[model samples]
Target: MPKKRILHGRIVLKDDIISGYLEVENGKITGISLAKPAISTETEFFDYGSQYIFPGFIDAHVHSFSNPDEGFEATSIGAAVGGVTTFVDMPYDRPHPIDNAAQFNQKAAKIAGHSVVDIALWGTIPKVDGVSEIPGLVKAGAAAFKMSTFETDPFRFPKISDVDIYNSLALLKHSKIITAFHSENNEMIVELIRRLKEADKVYPRAHMMSRPIIVETTAVQRLCEIAKWTGGKLHIVHVSAPETVDIIEAYRQQGVDVTCETCYQYLLLDVHDLERMGPRAKMNPPLREPETVSGLWQRLAAGKINYITSDHVPWPAEAKQKGDQNIFLAPSGLPGIELLVLAMFDAGVATGKLSPQVFAQLLATNVAARFGFKNKGQIVLGKDADFAIIDPSQTTTITDAGLHTRTDAITPLAGKTLAGQVTATWLRGRPIYQRGQVVAPMDYGEFVPGAEFGNQLAPGGDGLVFEA
Candidate 1:
């Protein structure tokens, strides 16, 4: 018989939270009992008492290589400390994007060697004729395909043409794989920024003015129509407006397979923070007004939004300092993998606006189901024994010096006190993070293939030969 381990705690399940114990054997959950079970000398027992045992979080949006300084090793360490067992890395890497089977294979190899926690990869297409590479990447185990309506970099992150978008959707109509997008109107944002620069309005608020809510909503609406026409599944990332959720819901009601996710910053911080923190708080689809932020919280509580993500990007201080005088000069995004779970639990659950079950759904369950992580995201039988144990009585104060990421000073939430501290984190029944340190080896993580992986590959083939 395999060695068994039993953990006793306040387990948060799919429908309820109960005082119980969970049994693990060979890295899989074997049994769960609401009442305490008999512990024998053969089974190792660990008691957490009243601490909450949540399913290890899954952050759907992450950019480990966006800043080459912060690669899989550092990012995965931060993720483990934050109680995230699995994260889906974006395809927009620094030197070269993963847009083909060869590039995807290289990245997968890197993940296996460098990451300390499980990682799933996203793939993208090149600027021109990129849709042709989709099938190959899908076979290479890409969790999803990401495209952008607004071009950040012409070669690294290009805006997909309408024709290409339509073609890609049509080709993937039957695959059931999600094609996500950075939805913002490029033309409108460019024109607005041109005018702002001409008027010398380079203040922090200019970031919000250049890309308003209309820019995001308009692009989302167009994508929804295309998905409607081709029957492709669609996802919008880092949505900042409440009305955008309304738009997605309207399309969802019409039977279009459309979903949207909001980042934790959008819920915890408002446009005021963008102005207050300047470049440090800069991000694409900039933060919304305070009223809009409140409306977004209401939509989240109402279950109109599908899930939440960190959009974890760790840019250096110099990158953000460039925008100290001109907001647009700074690169967008901030580090969040190390703080997403703690911040959300403090603001949402500790405040009594959200229950523990809803918190798990937003951060873990929905992300797993949406991204096709079959073995993760729950604490039930047959699932991976991944957990984030939290002691609610303890509080954590965010600080740059305490961060595990490379660029710790780039976040605006530094010094914020959050309720509940992560006491330990387990990945596949192994303790990866405990008592403020990562205990797992760098190569402990494994690659998680997408749902369409098996269907795309030919049987008994080492190379990517598409199945007819």
Candidate 2:
């Protein structure tokens, strides 16, 4: 609303950290100065003292509008407070699936006034390609077309056939919209499920055992080949295996137009946590062993994993309770939209798994480049004044009262102690979340579009946190 200056702190930028002041005017960053610039009395100033400010997080793979009761308002409450300013949501829903243009438009209408942060929508492959409106949805601004080799639902999420996938990729070959897949070989999973059940291995380990690394590797290997043949922009979602990263990296080295995203669950937790928490920690492409988890972290730090996301799923306690009787029956998703950035800062950044430069890349920079978010994912002039002012001086414990999921209960990550806490989140130069509360209006959020695969993306950034 007013010309403002963020002063007297270490400013984080793409390559070098400047101990300076940042200027914002009309919802955009206009300047970065090494010294306090002469200012008029009309200019408001907020000295950050010694806090670390980073670009607001962009989470790309979260489940929203997957049910009638679900919308962006409740989740964006968590997102805003938790430092996510933009999110690309999944296409599965109970009453309306985002398989066609009309359905996509209807869901967009549903979230019109409810979103509190920038929202992007994903479309899906329908059972019948003849009837599916992929081109129309793409023209209507779908971020990507999502399909799964492993079906999560019959009517809502049937597995796409290989022929269908190849045809769809061929159709999308030159299109800017990328094709994303949930890659797990369904046939192998079915057989493993049968064997695990016959042996009466009903423990949480069964979930992991049933879908071993091969399940993901095989699917990834095959999908890479299909994607190569069809020349479609391909991306794999919520990858859980180190081998999956290896496969994708190998393809990248070969110069394939492909990328893959991993989740916070795989990076922060392991099978033991799932064993203890049961279905609360249960998720597809399930969490791996301790060694595998270690390997994944190394891969991420080494820049093999393209980016990270929450894969934020919010299945109620009721369903998970039923899943407790049988891990297979347990819904596969862990709610983490509110915890992804903070928890990673706690585990990855503070522990030196990633430098601030690399951490920024993992959460926002790489994401923006991969998905073609030309406007965001960095703190720089001419971009939206979106940032998360973090208090890295103290520890914050995640608790039930601090969560903002639609369920209003704790997430799987609750009770974990994180290194830094987000004090405020600014979207378009406006403070939407502050002091552990979301203060933005329902109408503040708008839909953001993905640019072409090789769009002119914003530059990456790094920062120094001088002790106050």
Candidate 3:
């Protein structure tokens, strides 16, 4: 057995945030005890004083290869600095979309030696003949599978009909896998955008006007109906409105077996910011009114929302520089992988809007449990030694120069001051980020798939449900 070192600090575990000591041996937790002087003469030790030690966060929904300029390393560095130990990236527009087992393995081989932290991939299950690839892809280590209910590009994201959706779900019935849906009625939005553009009202507001609350609510309602009809596990990715959460809560009350997540942008920013930032704030399912933000916080406080992810998609300003033309031409997504954890801690914990347990549940535990990552999410003895030392009193202003991502676009929270900051992060008891810089091994991550709870979603199936 390897020798142990005692780390003393203000520790934040699953349901308790207390000042204590933690022992680590061979990159795993050994014990949690009250703070005291060392008994063994040869014992090694590190003290964090008053800093808060929290389990490293996991980004459940992210686009690893979305931004052209912000390549893999940039995103990884940003993630590390943000105290994220594992990133579950979607496989939508990569050079090789996950169509077959061969292509899935090819992409896995590409990311095998590139990441600095743990990674899980979301495979694309095309609505065509590619339905047969689900089992093989899962066996080959796909983190989850994603499909759009709306129409998408022919080769990239093929939309599936209701019959095809059920067919794919039936094939994956025994696999106990998670099926994530984009959750928008494509034909409705397409027609709305067409009419708005023809009427010469294609502004940023028009984008929101095109995809109304009914667009998302109707899709979510349909997904719940499908889940009730078929017992397939489903996850709704990147929810935008308060009404959506109400619907999800109601579904859970009715016992629907669904798990859903909302992004940081939806919780923090509002529609007024979009008017000022223009294309910078123009993301899919545009930000809603301030009352919606309040409703989301209430749900978050009540433990109704499952996870909080960054959905970190960073497109350079040059790529989204067409704000003058139609807003439809502008690319969606914003950069926040480096600031998500800090923002959540400050807004959720410091403000007293959420309990520390809710913070952990939304940021870590629920994500790990929902996705089936056996070694991640918790600070338990048998789990992976992934943690971050946070200084809640330290304040910083968000700015472009302070970021670590490859893209040059500014953060939406730029100029806003936030309390609490991540001082260091550890993966498997080895330091990956310290003193605001990355220090982890470069080739240090592996892919996880179809873990134990892969098919066992939350109890009251509340949220969008897609079969495949």
Clash totals for all candidate models? 0, 4, 6
> Each model's C-alpha lDDT?
0.90, 0.80, 0.77
Candidate 2: tens digits of C-alpha lDDT, residues 116-226: 888888888687662246667876678888899987787688888887787777777666678899999999999999999999897888899999999999999999988
Worst 10 residues of 3 by lDDT: 453-462
Prediction 2 global C-alpha lDDT: 0.80
Model number with the top lDDT: 1
Residue pairs in clash, model 2: 13-461, 13-462, 14-460, 14-461
TM-score for model 2? 0.93
Misplaced by over 4 Å in model 3 are 1-3, 37-44, 452-468
> Candidate 2: misplaced stretches above 4 Å?
1-8, 130-132, 408-410, 452-468
Mark the regions of model 1 whose C-alpha exceeds 4 Å error after superposition.
457-468
Q: Please give the ranking of all candidate structures by lDDT, highest first, separated by commas.
A: 1, 2, 3
The alpha-carbon RMSD values of the candidates against the true structure, listed in the order shown, are 3.9, 7.9, 3.9
- 308-398 per-residue lDDT for model 1 (tens digits): 8999998888778999999989999999998999999999989999899999999999989987889999888999999999899999999
Q: Show the colliding residue pairs in model 3.
A: 176-455, 256-461, 257-460, 257-461, 258-461, 258-462
lDDT tens string, model 3, 144-191? 788877765666766777765665555554555677888888889989
